[model samples]
Target: MRKIIVSAAAAALLASGSVAFAAVKHTTGTIKTFDATAMSLVLDDGSSFTLPKTFKDPGLQVGEKVRVSWEMSGKNKVAEAVKIAK
Candidate 1:
């Protein structure tokens, strides 16, 4: 019984941690804003992000549609921005 309880607790902890890691995918949208100081990027969907430390793309300016691969910290998303895929 104690082992079973321990297993359940472990499972719950795992589930909680899993929620922190966001899925990586290609999101294409125009830049709504950019904050160089904060290192944040805002997309046209009204969603925003503090640029992930993993992002490597340059030429990221406002009003450009960029294909980015990002993760989510809850509803907040941060991209490892690839490039402006023209």
Candidate 2:
């Protein structure tokens, strides 16, 4: 009974941690610049984010609307996903 209770508590803690880690913010704006060499992008709103090397191309181009999902990595904003917004 004690082991079962401990296991349940551990599972709950792990679930909460995952939720916290998955809490990424979204930004929507026009693509001001896309530096493929640097793997980063800047929005017209003056927001800049670093992209993960594994990020797939979303057919990005300047002057196009896009939505970016990102999270804070250290002192930098790291992009998790990007999508072209109609």
Best by the lDDT measure? 2
Candidate 2: tens digits of C-alpha lDDT, residues 2-84: 99999999999999998897689999999999998899999999999999989888789999999999999888999999999
Cα error, residue 59 of model 2, in Å, equals 1.1
Candidate 2 clashes between residue pairs 3 or more apart in a chain or in different chains: none
Clashes of each: 0, 0
Candidate 1 lDDT (Cα, whole model)?
Answer: 0.76
RMSD in angstroms between candidate 2 and the native structure over all alpha carbons: 3.0
- Backbone clashes in candidate 1 total 0
State the lDDT at 58 in candidate 2.
Answer: 71
Give all candidates' CA lDDT scores: 0.76, 0.94
lDDT for model 2, please: 0.94
**Cand. 2 TM to true fold:** 0.75
Worst 10 residues of 2 by lDDT: 17-26
